[model samples]
Each structure stands twice: as structure tokens, then as C-alpha cells.
Target: MADKSTEGFYEVFEVFSKRNEKTDMQYQFSLLAPNHEMALAMAQENFMRREPVIDIWVIKRSDIRKMTEEEKETLKRIDNKDYRLTKGYGYLKKKWREYEQGVLDENEILSWGEDKDATDRKRTTS
Candidate 1:
């Protein structure tokens, strides 16, 4: 009887959703349901009722290829891909400093949107 119950419960399904068509689907959680249709209906109301969801997927737990304990232990390497980030090119800062040139950083770029001259005229005339 215990084995029978375990077999029945093995039909657990995981729910996932994508915020938009371009975004990747993220796992919400797992729930037990008898069939795929029932799982999908329950997932929409339970997990995505409060947020934007353009796509949904219901996958059986058994279908997922999960990593073992040994794989997880070996996967904990440092993510030192400095070549992929601005931090890797930090030497450019010193090079620019030698030229006495200020870097056009994010703040300076955003400041270009401010119409300071217009605002000054409005303040003086008003």
C-alpha cells in the first residue's frame, strides 16, 4: 500500500512562466495534479495571477534531468570571467587619466537629457 501511494504521488508537475515572448521561462514551483491540463489551469491561478505572464509550461518532475550531489560539489568554481565585464578592462581608466580626459560615464550621458538652459530662462522670466 505504501509503494502504491508513492507511485501515485510521482506525478508531481513543476510550473513555469515567461514574462514576455523574448524572456526565458522561470520556474515558479511544483504541485501535484492528475493531468497536464489540470496542472496548467491550477498553475495560472496559483502562481501568475498577480504578474504578467505570456507563456506557461507544466513539466513532470520525472522528466527533468537534475544534477547529483557530486556534480553540485564540483560546480562551485569562481565566476572569474573578467573578460566579459567592464572590470576586466580597468586599465583603460588609467590610460584615459594619463590623457587628462574625463570618462563619459552613465551619469554624464544621462545629464545630456537635462535642458538646464531652458529651465534657467523659465526660472528668471517667471
Candidate 2:
């Protein structure tokens, strides 16, 4: 009998998926597979069993250039930029209501350059 070594038979594949069309593709996990097809099959098998994902992507790990230890350390330092998401500014809604004004939400913000009449119609339809 002859012995065969499988040294570079399989490689790491990073998996990414999203729940629906509107959601962003997030890093799900990683897996080892011999090729892209097998990697995708493994990702689909794992993620599909856990959740209903609208999309799945599997890419060679070597293709991605992740942050180095120093880069990560820099990211962990103090004085990081302050970010206030819409949820963090919920109080503004009440404040604006008190002034008889509506809060400019995502849809309103996106419709800024469009026709006010069209925007109003879209809002009403929604």
C-alpha cells in the first residue's frame, strides 16, 4: 500500500452572509474546503441550517488583508471618534414634536434632493 500526504489539500474560506436584501453582508464564520465550490457548499450547509439567509459568500482567506496586531492596538486606543446613531438621538423626536416639527429620519434624509411632492406621496403610500 502507498501513503499519500494531504498537506495543502484544503484551505481556509471566510464566510459572509446576510438575512435579507436590505441588510449588510456580515462575517458569519470560516471553514476549510478544498475549493471554492466546496467552501460555498459548506457555508450554505452550516448557515442555512441555523438561519434563513438571503445571500452567502465564501472567499479565500489569503485574499483578505486583515488588521495587524499594531493596527488593532491603534484601534483600541482612547479618543476614538464619537458616533451618535439615530437610536441614540431618540430624544430629538420629542424635542422636534414640541416645536411642531417632524424628525428627519432615514427616509426623509434620503429624499432631500428629490421633489417634495414625490417624497410626500411616497411617505403617504408607506
Candidate 3:
């Protein structure tokens, strides 16, 4: 076999996929291919041979822009933006209780997206 390192035949490619149209894309696995097309083709056979994949992506590892240690440190700078989080509005729960009304927390707000009957049943059961 030819020397892959010198010829660049062993280029690393990261794979990502989604199970269905509504699902979020997730990391699959990495593969070595000479080019993007081959990497995409190989990904289906190697990773999705026996599974259902709604979408697939093959990105050359070298093409991804990654932050260096120094750049990453800049992201650690903190800002006083507590008002953007639910904790900042925690006093609303007590205020609502004073009015004899319930306050919807994060979980309650998120559960609104589920079936109404199911959510009601879950609330009753718990």
C-alpha cells in the first residue's frame, strides 16, 4: 500500500447524522477517506448499514475551526446577566402564591409542549 500520511489519503473526517426529520443531528463516528465524497459514501456503509439515517454529514477534520487554549480562555469571562435565567425570577413563585395562583417553572413550561391530556394525567398521578 502507498504511504497514506505523505499522500494525504488518510484524511480524517467527522460524521454526523439524524435519525429522522424532526430529530437533532448528533455525532456519529470518524472515518479516514481521501476526499469528502468518499468519506460520505463510506459513512453510510460503515455506520448506517443496518440502521435508519435521515441525514448524514461528513466534515473534514482539518476544515473545522476550533478555539485555541488562549481563545477559549476569553470565553470564560463572566457577565452579570442573571436576569436572563429562571433563578433571577424565582421571587415570582412567592408572589404568585400570595395571589393564590401557581407559578410555571422551567419543567412546567417545557411540559406544555406535550399532549395536554398526558400532561394532566402525569400531574394527577404524581
Q: Clash totals for all models, in order?
A: 0, 0, 0
Q: Candidate 2: which pairs clash?
A: none
Q: What lDDT does the true structure give each of the candidates?
A: 0.82, 0.83, 0.85
lDDT of 1 by residue, 1-126 (tens): 348766775479998889987889898889988888888889888756588788889998888998999999888857777798877898987897877665576777667656676788899999
- The number of clashing residue pairs in model 2 is 0
The residue pairs that clash in candidate 3, if any, are none
When summed lDDT is taken over every stretch of 10 residues in candidate 1, the lowest stretch is 1-10
Please, what is the TM-score per model?
0.48, 0.49, 0.63
lDDT string for model 3 (1-126, tens) is 777566765789999998998999999888889798899999988766678988898999999998999999998848888899889999987887877555557777777766687888899999
* Of candidates 2 and 1, the better by TM-score: 2
Ranked candidates, highest TM-score first: 3, 2, 1
Taking the tens digit of each residue's C-alpha lDDT, what string does model 2 give over 42-81?
9988986889999998999999998899889987748634
Ranking by lDDT: 3, 2, 1
Model 3 CA lDDT for position 40: 91
**Distance from true position, residue 21, model 2, in Å?**
1.5
Candidate 2: deviation at residue 96, Å? 21
RMSD of 2: 19.1
